[model samples]
Target: MDLQQMRYVVAVAETRNFTRAAERCFVVQSSLSHRIAGLERELGVRLFARSSRRVDLTDAGAAFLVGARECLAAADRAVADAAAATGVVRGRLAVGVIVTTAAVDVPELLQRYRARHPDVHVVLRPGHSAELAAAIRNGDLDIAFLGLPESERPSGVESVVLDHDKHVLVVQAEHRLAGASQVALREITEETFVDFAHGSPGRAQSDEAFAAAGLVREVAYEAGAGELMTRLIARGLGVALLPSAFIRPLAADNPELALVPVVDGPRRIEWLAWSRFNPSPATRAMLDVLGVVRHA
Candidate 1:
């Protein structure tokens, strides 16, 4: 019946608990429950299947939530646009990032963005490139910073190329390849490897390089983060393929880890992706700060 009631239903649905939902919405549990109860009575339908342990949305509630979310998004956009017209950019800016990338210093960049637009709410979601790109297409993220292989480009969204770099081999101090100045991918075929999860953008480059050379290397470990991958290599668990720019900052801190140039290495491409349909003013400002002259 009201936007506030719809918000309560949404919060309860997402959290699946009245207490947590109330906490998230900054309301008392009793007030939130009373509000939803009134809404259910007004709509002539039970919105939730309540229990002692958890709460689940009824079929009607599920249907209602879809419209509720859309209405909320539209309302937010209206408010944001009105503010933009007054030369004040005030809105939520959800950003997705590929963790451990060296294409651009994200913290410093965001610091500048925050300084300029203090009214905007900035949310950071660190994830894999593919996941970030999907979020951009889904309108879950206002913008994203992605790193994919040179052989591939992000599809389904407008994006710009920011940087290009190559991969390097990471090994333990005592590993056979550690003493070598540089080595070919073929020479390390027998060595166990550590890499990003299969089918991931980060994994694709390493996978493609070996596939192109008609060789199969065993990736004994899958690391979600660069620090974890370097740690695994330091323990002699497996050698890894890392970005060239990332090696310098990591080598001193991880003394047990050594970097060896790969004669034939996979190339990385960094991209900045934004929504093709109505990017927020905050998103545009952030891109402007990044020197993104125009959308792709």
Candidate 2:
């Protein structure tokens, strides 16, 4: 019935818990619950299926949430547009970044953006590319830096390529393949692998490359961070396919690690993505500062 109520609905839907949603919205749990109940009654439909453990949206709730998100986005854009008209860019910009990418100069970009729009508040969340893509699609993030295949980007989002880096095979210095300049996927198929979790973008790309070569790798260990993966490799755990940019600097300090190019591996394309819908003025300003122009 109101923007505040819509925000409450969206926050609850995103967090999936009344207590956490209230915390996110800076309201008391009882007040959030009461308002949501009033909203459900006013709409003549339940927005959420309550439970002791977790909250789930019913079919009706899911249907209503789509419009709720659009409405909230519109409201935000209206305010941002008004501020822009006044020659001021002011609002919260929620940004998501892939955890293992070295291609993006996030710190420098943030510094410049902050200097240009001192009034705008920027919040950064780090996650795997898939998780960041999901957050951007859910309206939880205004923009994100993601590692995606050039041809298979997420739907409902517009993206610009920020940079490209190739995946390389990392091994301990004494490993048999360490002396090789470039190794084929099949050559390393039988070697124990250390890689990102199964669903992560990096892991998915590596898996697809091997699958394309008619080879399957046994993942002996999984790590979420490139540093941990390097540490694992240095400890002689197994070989891994990681971004060359990520491994190069670390390899400089660790003499025992080797970085060999994967002959036909996937290239990691880093993209800055935002909703193709009406993006907020803050989002647009940052994108402009980053030298990306969104097409209509």
Candidate 3:
């Protein structure tokens, strides 16, 4: 009924011993017993069974325990909500970052965030766009970097377009297309390709660009990691259509790989996402550090 009564009942249910529960509740044993009796009288149910050696919940008490826990949790959440409303950003912030960006700048951003907000606990989870999107929608991730599907952004998500990454072609230097100054999308359609696995945002973008150009490139290898895909390409398995950034350093050092710009390719939109209904100050602070402004 009252907060104090709920507290007393929950304590007794937890300890199953009147004396121990009283100690835990910081009340006298007799006071704890009186409070539980008062609660049982109000509810019109026998809430507990007591004997010389043990204390146990009655059938009704077991059912009431569930509601008691829920009420306590609600009270705790109310207190937490009040604390967060004052802009005191100190709590757990879970982020879901895509695999490719995780290897690039997300770590740097998270490092800077931790340095700035030492009191905040950061949990970084790496996932692809679809998984990240689902995590945000399911309340598993506080924020995520997602690649929204074209013509179909999922409902009830707050997201901002971070950037548009251009797609580029990666091939071994000794390949026939390498000798050419710049190869067209149609020109490389016949060449073998190292592609992203199905359901990936990159794979979808690659398909979109190739379809636009009316070209269907042959996929010789399909893999998860970019480094692994590049390695496969290096072995002369096939070429790959990847973000321009991933291929930059490899092109500079490795004489075997040529990072050529895709003259015709669809652009991939990078998005930063959070739930529409669950906005926490900690997540807002992290988003600010990452230079993302929230959009509906």
User: Model 3, stretches more than 4 Å misplaced?
Assistant: 1-87, 102-104, 148-155
Ranking by TM-score: 1, 2, 3
The residue-level lDDT of candidate 3 at 170 comes to 86
lDDT of 3 at 89: 61
Rank by lDDT (best first): 1, 2, 3
**Who is ahead in lDDT, 1 or 2?**
1
> For residues 1-296, what per-residue lDDT tens digits would candidate 2 score against the true structure?
89889899989999999999999999999999999999999999999998889899999999999999889877877887899999999888999987666776789999999899998989999888878877888788989988875446766787887778888899999998889979888788899999888877878878888777788789999988888888899999899988777678889999999989887986778878897767888999998898886677
lDDT of 1 by residue, 95-170 (tens): 9988757888989998999888899999999999999989999889989889988888989999989888889898
Point out where model 1 deviates above 4 Å: none
Provide the overall lDDT of each model, using Cα atoms, as 2-decimal numbers.
Answer: 0.89, 0.86, 0.77
lDDT score, candidate 1, position 283: 87
Off by over 4 Å in 2: 1-75
TM-scores, all candidates, are 0.96, 0.77, 0.69
On the 0 to 100 scale, the lDDT of residue 281 in model 2 is 86
- The residue-by-residue lDDT of candidate 3 on 68-144, one tens digit each, is 87787567546546767775567678898775662337778878988877777888887778878788887677888
TM-score of 3: 0.69
